[model samples]
Target: MASFHLVSLGCAKNLVDSELMLGSLLAADHRLVDTPAQADILIINTCGFIQPAVEEAIEEILALVAVKNEFPEKKIAVVGCLVQRYRDDLVAELPEVDLFVGTEGTAGFADLLAKMIRGENPGRLVLPERSLMDSTLPRVLTTPPFRAWLKITEGCDNHCSYCMIPSIRGPLRSRPVNDLLQEAVRLAAGGVKELSLIAQDSSAYGRDLAGADLPTLLQALLAETDIPWLRLLYLYPSGITPLLLELIAGNRRIVPYLDIPMQHVSDPVLAAMNRHYRRRELESLIAVSRQVLPDVALRTTFLVGFPGEDEEQFLAIEDFMRQHRLDHVGVFAYANEEGCAAQGLAGQVPAEEAIRRRDHLLNVQAELAAARQRQYLGRTLEVLVEGVSAETDLLLEGRSRYQAPDVDGCVYINDGTANPGDLVQVRITDSQVYDLVGEIVPDVGLAKEKNTARG
Candidate 1:
């Protein structure tokens, strides 16, 4: 059996695709390796979402090429969005790569590699058109055993002027509700306690699937399984319906957290970006969410310097964030992607200006995050242990229901000795900008504690 190593870069969606590819290869009796140097085949699942991401992908490919030079017999392959976007150009520029596969062609990776091994050229394998084949493919889970990302939909329909997702990923296509449930059940059965529902636009889920919506799907998941936490990620602001809020408020399993990517708050910027919501409408939605779920963790992403975004617009976004005091915030400097509508628009901000705007917004968010975290001080919270801290090996690292993995901060448990998957109560002792320091709560019941204190 040939040994291979796959390096996945970008969002959870790309990670899911890589997992599916890995599973297919493993099923075909291929051995998996940790590094490119140790493998006979190297596959890179790349991202071409933005300029920085594209540059990172190219750097990775070049590093692999250096490895290939050292061991001329080993082969290298590139797959995913980068390949889909720049097929012929990549092939021409990076001749060291032996195989090139696109996003739609990833499902046939094993067969493609087999052909390459047999001396077939297998040139560029970009699909002529997008196909929604919900492969019941196996996956070699790369995440911690306790948590796994369940991709409910593939591709995106929204053609945001600043985004390249639609052109690179094609139209929105959701997996059937039954298929998603089966996958969730399988993951849960395999010891996954937390399942984060992920997609390009999770709120737009089931728009393609007749008689299905996100809330309905959530209800089905709650009724069908017993996963400890069902967190929703990548929900759009415009789709945050009253029904959805009510379902979240009532459902015990669904985490009271939403990752809504509100790109910008200014009406002009929103219109230029092709987003449907304006400043007032977004404020109304936030007010409604706060009214319904008082403690809901609102995580959002904002684009700081899009084409035609002025100083006033930037300040408006900053003011909006300050007013909301969001639980989590991600600020991105806009990049002019080729073929995007914003590419041809006038009034492109200088790179320095973009950086300044991004930094200023981030500073605001840091202060807000610290203040929000302070509110939890001395309170006991349920935390899922994810790993042991490297800085202080005795301390355990984990996240509360309010924090998502990787993107959000984690809580540090200083007192308790717990396993990776154990859910334990921890008393918050201190708070930082993006993390919490806590001590594990003792097992002594509240009544016992009062009696002991009295004695």
Candidate 2:
């Protein structure tokens, strides 16, 4: 039984993959160590969506290589999107890596590594299969026991001109409804209170499946799992159906939180990027969401400086953001990556200008988020305890139903004795730019508590 360590990078979807790999190794009786230096094997799950992500992954690999050098017997493997996207290129550049596994190749990693360790020649490059993970697959929860990510689908079919997901991840593959529900049941049984449903485009789930769709899957999950909070992420604007909206509006367990990645709001830019929805459609969708779920927390992402995105177009997106005052927004400058259709497109926004736009959007959202936070003041909210606050040990930190893990803000409990994974009621007392300050109600029962927060 070899000791192994993992460095998982990128989005929650990739994190799920890392957890699966970890679970597989653990089931095989391999021990997990805290650091690479103490492990006989080190694995890096990488992201290659953009140039910056690629560079970040490469830097981490190099750092791990240094660690491997210190321990000559330690083996290193690099896997995931980076390997899928740049297999040949990475192999040529990173000859020191013992194995390279892509999205599809991840399933067989444990056996492949075992062969390599046994002095058998397992080929360095693994070709990924076009498939989706089901409930039968093993996974070790990486998130806190109270919260877990449930990736329901794999790959992309949108084929946006500016994106390369379809090429790297292959076509859309939805997991069987029974499979997802079984996994959720297992998670809930293990004390998971919040389950964030994720996919390349969550709203697109079950499109390729027979007689199945997102709403149906959601209803099944709600009926089967006793989890307290079910959040949805990575929902494309165009895929937001009326039935889905109705389901979200009516279901209390399904938190009123939406994460839609609206790349841009300008018609011309949208066309250039091959986004299916128009400006009007996006506006209508937002309006409908607001009308249906008044208290819904809308989280979105905007890609600035796409090819041919002029100042006027950029201003349009800014105007839309100002008008909507979204609960959470992520703004990113475009990176022209090879293999993406946008790479050779004309009128590429300059790097400096893109950075300027990204910064401007971020500043705008900061103020908007601060204003949104002010609403929670004095309101009682259900907060799932995560752990001790990073800012100070005197306070415990967790998130409200409106706040998704990691990407969204957190609520710092000024006075509470609740343990991690426990859901407690907290009354908002103060607000920050991106976080909330709260205290457990005086009468609220905790596993351990001595006095009221005001005392």
Candidate 3:
């Protein structure tokens, strides 16, 4: 059996694809290694969603090529979005790469690897066809023991002007509800307490499936098993339906958190970016969420600079942030990717201006996040213990329901002993812009009992 090492870079969706590819490799009797130096084959699952990401992917491929040069017996293969988007160009530029597999043609990864192992040059296998939904193979999760990213769908149909997702990933395709449930069940059975539902647009889930929608899938998932937490990510503001809101409010399993990537608050910019929601509609959605779930932790990503975005539009976003006081916020300076419609549009903001705008937005978000976290001080919250700090073994790190895995902040447990993956009650003592220091409450059962008696 051949030994291989795979490096996955990009979003959670790309990580899921890499995990599936790992499972395929394992099933084909290939031994997995941690580093390229220890493997006969090195696979890189890359991202090409944006310009910066494309550059990073290319650099990573080159780094692997250096390793291949040192070890001529080891072969290197590139797959995923980067390969999907620039297959021909990459093959021409990076001749050191042994194989280049596209997103659609990834199902045959095992065969490709087998051919390369036997000294056959597979060249570039960039399949133009888009795979059907529910066709995704099973994945071998690469996350922590307690948490797993459950991808409900693949690809995206939303051809946002600045987004290259549609070009590389193809159209939106929802996995079967039954398949998702089975995966969820398996995860739960394997002692996974937290499942982060991920996709290009999670809110647009199941529109392609017959009689399936976000609410319907959530209901089905809730019915199947009682996972400790079901967190949603990449929810489009335009697709936040009333039924979905109801599910978020009523379902105890669903955490009161949403990651809606509203790229811009300005209506003009939104329109230019092909975003369907307007400023008024966004306000209404936030209002409805706050009305229904009073403690809902709203997280959003905003693009600071885009084509046609002016000073006034930037101020509008700042005003929105001040008014809304989001629990978590991510800011990105827009990068013009090749083939994106936004690239052809006029009024491109200067790079320096874009960086300044992005910094300003981040500064605003930092203040807002700090202020919001301060509110949690002195209040008891449930945190899932993830790990202990290396600097100080006494400091345990975990996250509340409000905090998503990587993008959001974390809860630091300063006192009390808890193993990784244990859900414990903690009292917030101090707050930072993106993290909280808390004392883990010992005797959680006693506290619950006391509260129950008082009630």
Candidate 4:
């Protein structure tokens, strides 16, 4: 049995795919290693959505190549978007890599690599992908046992001009409701308290199916699973229907948080980027969300410095951000990727200018997030304890429903005796720009916590 060290790069969706790869290899009797030097094979699941991500992937491969040199017999495998996107280019550019797996990562990888390693010599590249994912496939949960990402759908139908996901990952394919339910049940059984549903287009889940949609699937998941908190991520603004908002408001199991990826709101820029929604529509969306889901922590991402985005257009985006004061916000500089529609468009923003806009907006969001965090002070909320703090073992760190794992900040518990994965009441003592300072209070029941939070 060959020992392998797999490095998974990019988003949470990619991480799930990495887990699937790991599961496939392990099921085939391959052992996993913690580091490159300890392994006979090194696998890299890379992201190539944009040029920068590709550069990052290349850097990782070069680092691994150095390690591979130490043991001349050790094999290197480069997989995922980088290979899917620039397979021909990568094969020529990176002869050091032996195996190349694409986005359609399936059980084929396990068998193919096993044979190739035994037969092959110094260095080369090889591979293809097929099959949809389901509950039947064994996955080693890479995240903490308390929290896991449940990717509901694969690929993207919305082909934004500046984005390459549709080309790299392909079109939408939602998992069956029964299949998802089975997975949820398995996760709950394995002690996962928080399961966040993720996808390229989450709100559009089950659109391909005749009878199933997001709400229907959500009801089933809530009714069936013992998991306490289920959060939604990467929902397009228009897809946040009134019925969906109502369901989230009424059910405590469905955490009061929404992750809307509104790339831009300016009409001209939105049109150029091929986004369907308008400024007025987004305003209405926020207004309705605030009215219906009062406790909801709204999060969104904005792409600044698109090809046609001028100073006036960018100001509109900044103005909208300042007006909304969203709970969480992420800003990204537009990537002028090759083959994207925007690459041929006129009036491209300069790199320094784009970075300037990104940094400025991030600073604005930081101030807004700091102000928004104050509301939690002197209130009670349920926190999923995540063991000792990274900063200090003297303190414990956990996440509230408002805070999504990794992307959002944590609640640092200064005085608390709770194990990891334990769901307990935390009284908000203080707050930061993004993080929170709290103490565990066993006495504050769920009902009391809700009432206290409302006050």
lDDT of 1 at 347: 95
lDDT of 1 by residue, 343-428 (tens): 99999998889999999999999999999999999988878898798568889999998999889999998887899987778999
RMSD of 1: 4.1
lDDT of each: 0.88, 0.88, 0.86, 0.88
Tens-digit per-residue lDDT, 97-131, candidate 4: 78777887544678777677679542354445444
Residue lDDT tens for model 3, 1-455: 79998999998888877888888889899999888899999899999888888889999998899999999888888998988888888888988888888886556688888887877866556454787424246568799889999888888988999988888888889988888898888889988989998989998898888999888888888889668788999999989888777777776668889889999999999999999989999899999988888889999989978988999999999999999998888899987888899999889999999999999989988888889999898988888899996447779999998999988889888889899998888999999988999987765563343212111
Q: What TM-score, computed on C-alpha atoms, does each candidate reach? A: 0.96, 0.96, 0.95, 0.96
lDDT of 1: 0.88
Cα distance off (Å), candidate 3, residue 362: 0.6
For model 2, state the Cα shift of residue 421 in Å.
1.3
Clashes of 1: 0
Cα-based lDDT at residue 39, candidate 3: 95
